[model samples]
Target: MDWMRDWVQAVRECEGGALGTVLCLALLFVWYCYRVGCEHASYTPESRSSPPELSSAKLRPTLGGVRTGGGASEEELNGFAYCQSPECFRCSRPGNGFNQRLYHNLQDYAKRYTWAGMGRVHKGVREQDRYRLCNRPSIQKAEVFFLPDLPSAPFFSRDAQKHDVELLERSFPALLAEFESVYRTPPPLAPGWKANSTPRGHWWTFYLVNQGTTLALNARRCPRTWRVLGQLRTFISNNVFGNACFSVISPGATITEHYGPTNVRLRCHLARLFTLDAASRGERRLRPTAGPERLH
Candidate 1:
């Protein structure tokens, strides 16, 4: 070993420049080999089989009150609140005086509106063997309803028709334009709430306020966009006795199954924003399912 060392030293001294360069190159090769080996080990099938366990410690409560993370506590988050939650209901009550007018308007309009169209019918048997169904829930599910198409249903009157058109043209155009601007793209203004669902193409919604005003627009309605405006006018003229809103759900998105509280009021969905997936549609998914539907 001593002799070998002596010989190596002599070679280094005699070929110092070449030896140094070779040494550097050899070190670089070893480093490259080590990096390749590490990469292979990291990407091995077994290593990739299970993703790194997400750290529950890093999870946080979102504003919507949903807890996320592998080990997040099942307990509901404090700050996060569902729109349908009792607390939210209290918060959402129209402010005194300000909301009174709004409420009165909606109530009056609703009284006159006789919902029509092919309203949905819910019929099913629960595990208890009891069967039940109604069109009211579908109306509520969509967060809107149509007036019955009858002469007495408030829609057939020429006066009501004129009133409805005036409301749509004056009050709703700006509101609809605002809605369109906000939802033209993904990731709506509200966090964790998409305006649309991935499976359902889009949602069409209408809003009726007190003071004889009506608003209607489709986030994704095509061609005669004005037609939707006209429909709102017609519906309101016939049914706008009480303050109310209307909605339409196009085919494709199954609003999933859900329930609501109270039977005195109904909800409806006005289909708009049509797309392949309802989940990816837009904002407003976070909005409560009208009045009666309860959120689980």
Candidate 2:
């Protein structure tokens, strides 16, 4: 309600003849309202009975667009926390031509800006990369580098451990059971890794968390594994790298040596049964005799 009040007040303060800004703002408002309405409409009383938690989970954006809920503390969650800085709302920078053109109502004004108008007004200014991994001097031979502050070790086991990697390893039986239950029936193993051009065999991924947001239907199917993942805070929850999935690789699959989009995130594998051979040239060859394997 407070946000709504501020948004309306900000609109009122805008001077006349700012037709471009007003039209853009109005279209954005309509889009927001439409999305809200459609979301609510999808959740009927009868539909709420099945997959209740997943269907009814309320997702509100936190600082830097990170979403948090389900009893996880801010510290436990990774990536950038929710932001409420004045810069998040303000657009009227002195001597900025784009700000002056876009935010004529906010230019040189002392009043606080609204969140709804924030995106529109701040369009011209390029947001600084919150985490740059490759630029660090210490980082070398890394494929993707964003948020290089995270642990970049080649491997960790026995002594060196950040979060509870063992917990996931121990819960393999329960997690695998849940995973099999989802893809076992009609839509068994959805084809994945369609974008990768180099893989010789096949790679299929059933994701629980895609870009830090939990998939409702998938989470509903794998409640046990999801709960297990909740115990560990190391999962990359950033926009791109944030994902946890069950990977099924065909036998003799040769996933060519390739760097992920970014290296700030760590890749952990919890194989039910698989033999991986690192080639001399850095290629990864997977030889799996089992049914399916889980990877995070």
Candidate 3:
């Protein structure tokens, strides 16, 4: 009976100590939460007399209102966008104004800026930019004695990329399927022009032609793309002076602002596939099962 009483007393003491500790912890947590809530409720915007600088120690801004690198996620940006302020990013205006960036990479900022620039121009500022392609100096014809110029043929006409587009349209499904099959397959990642990581949603490239040269190995790997490009050899034999590859920029991935070395080439994007919330944004989602009026 004495041993039983002693054991009971020890258990009671331990339980009482544990209960007191738990209550103390609970009170501390409640106080912390209360302090946090009070701080949030009392928060006010800091004076914005000066332009916000995002760390002079890092993230140097580049030409064309681009920054090389930063630290932010799309989710954070989206949450900010939902705030009552009418700012493009974190302010109270439609325009971000003065080299504002949202994404970690400058490319995303450029794309978003371009998207904003697509809107109707207000006052003197246009969201869109117009820049001329700089002709390649080395490829300049001595007899011509001037900058290189493309043929004056209508671009979409039968003589131009019409056949190429048609063939690609026909083979788009096969390309999509093949891409889905081989894009993430073991050892399927082709080298990027800028070797970004896999987590950055690889800028995967399966070259049909590169710098006026056909890649026999890559073509063998991607037969459908090869067949589609093959159909345009007659039209593109001479004009295929530069790379012709499908550049698949991964979702939420951003490539920095860059201009090709030569203006003699134009990279073409045949088709795009993305998933987005169509209902909220008042845009229709084009699904494979949806009415394909133009598929015929």
Candidate 4:
């Protein structure tokens, strides 16, 4: 009974000590937590400045006004000036004002007779070529006209007549032969005629007179020429212009540089004769003179 009592007392004393230790430890822990929390609350997050609000109306500027200079001017900011601005006009206008006006007027005039339908046979040519032939989407039947310098009067009596390729084929061969005979020999290699040195081979060309009345037959007289003309007619009816011309460029022939009167015309070369290695091949444009005599 004495041992039992002694063991109970010892156990009670140990339990009491453990309880006190636990209470002290818990108090220490609470103190540490409270200190950390108080420190965190004391260090409030640094206040941040808000970004400036942009006005929607200020995004695009008025036409004549200068832009805010954050870096470049708005015109400079966009990397290019607006097209309608007077500054843009001043910068972008062509150097030749008179020529520009003349060109614009000529374009307006050309719109009246320009073909609006797909080109008759050369439609399959390159897009660039087609554009050169006619600016419109398709060539209409009544817009064909002859150059005024032709030996004969204009052929078409009225604009109502449809252009027939068959007739052209029957007539173009003689003209081809004539052109061939005259241009067959190798072209001159002189400085002024540099385009004459390229190798050339003969080829035929037929034009559909969309607006003209000049019969293909009117251009020829001989029977053999008529046969050649017939071939041209057949090709035209079939809508084949890919192989029509025989192109030849002299070895070193440099065609002087000159822009066509309008962007609608494409130049085609039929190679009838050529030299193998002469320096006269292809077209070249001469530089314009700096002074009043601009011989280009």
Candidate 3 regions with alpha-carbon error over 4 angstroms: 1-160, 186-202, 233-240, 276-296
Evaluate all candidate structures by whole-model CA lDDT and list the values in order. 0.36, 0.49, 0.44, 0.33
What C-alpha RMSD separates each model from the true structure?
Answer: 26.7, 23.3, 25.0, 29.7
CA lDDT for candidate 3: 0.44
Tell me how many clashing residue pairs each candidate has: 75, 4, 2, 51
TM-score of 3: 0.38
Per residue, candidate 3 scores C-alpha lDDT tens digits across 10-102 of 999999999999999999999999977763442323313322222111124333432324333332222222224332122232223322331
Model 1 TM-score, 2 decimals: 0.23
Sort the predicted structures by TM-score, highest score first.
Answer: 2, 3, 1, 4
Q: Which ten residues in a row are the worst by lDDT in model 2?
A: 127-136
What TM-score does candidate 4 get on C-alpha atoms?
Answer: 0.21
Better of 2 and 4 by lDDT: 2
Q: Write the per-residue lDDT of candidate 4 for residues 218-264, one digit (tens) a residue.
A: 23323454355345422232211112222333333323111222222
Runs in model 4 lying further than 4 Å from the true structure: 1-95, 103-168, 189-247, 250-262, 266-296
Top candidate when judged by TM-score against the true structure: 2
Question: How many backbone overlaps does candidate 2 show?
Answer: 4
